[model samples]
Target: MLQIIVAMMLFFVMMFGIGFILNMLMKTTWFPIYLYLIVLLPLGIYYTWDDSMNFAQNMGAYTIVDYLPAITALAGAYISGTAIRSLRRGGYKMF
Candidate 1:
């Protein structure tokens, strides 16, 4: 339980850091989303493959839920970064 919490916190922090750097470099709202999906998807899959396989073996199937945390974290970071950028650019209201 604690480990999971720690892992999630770390994940969020790392994603935020990456998003910040990407935003600094690309200066676009959408590019980080594309970059995160393109770069992290394969890496996430590769890293989680063993755990996913074990879960499938035990539970008889694997589901998208298993990967939701990573997807959500990446998305949250990207959205937050984009919102920050927009706020900086004087787009106060979120829409």
Candidate 2:
């Protein structure tokens, strides 16, 4: 519904902006994606995991509504990295 669309956009913009800033400050191309995959994802899953459900069942419980925002956020992180890489290739030293 409208809420899902809004959440997806919000997550995408949040990730993009944060990743952009982090890349600029840390001078790293893909760190934000790594951070998202390695840190944020695990924490989120762990926090939401159900003790009664098996791993597969728990994972399978996520619908398109639940996954869309995460997918968009990941896309945002990847795009930010590509943007920084292009900027570096274009000879912008600060980025």
Candidate 3:
């Protein structure tokens, strides 16, 4: 329960941070910033877990699945930020 809560909190923080950055860099038009934020997270978690699993196996270490959410949050923030920047440049905003 605590882990889940923490993960959600992290996700929101990351999303907001990216949003702020994008808002500053973007010009204004039709890009789906929220869509990007929502979609990229799962991909990030999957990739991170896959890589982490491989690394742990090689090192003879172990891990729990609880870490994936945090990874997704971090990666989601980054992907969202980049997407926002691209969209802004492509001319998507409300100015």
Best candidate according to TM-score: 2
Q: List the residue pairs that clash in candidate 1.
A: none
Residues 51-89 of candidate 2: C-alpha lDDT, one tens digit per residue: 999999999988999889999999999999999999999
lDDT of 3 by residue, 1-95 (tens): 78776776777577656655655556422223444546664565455454535755633442344455645555555555676667667886642
Better of 2 and 3 by lDDT: 2
Which 10-residue window in model 2 sums to the lowest lDDT? 40-49
Taking all chains together, each candidate's TM-score versus the true structure is: 0.61, 0.95, 0.38
Stronger candidate by TM-score (1 vs 3)? 1
* TM-score, prediction 1: 0.61
Please write out the lDDT profile of model 1 over residues 1-95, one tens digit for every residue.
67666666776677777776666666666666676788877675666566635755734444554554676678667765776677767855342
Q: Rate the local accuracy (lDDT) of all candidates.
A: 0.65, 0.94, 0.55
Query: What lDDT does model 3 reach?
Result: 0.55
Give the per-residue Cα lDDT of candidate 2 at 21.
Answer: 98
After the best TM-score superposition of candidate 3, give how far the Cα of residue 13 lies from its true spot, in angstroms: 1.0
- Candidate 3: regions farther than 4 A off: 29-39, 45-95
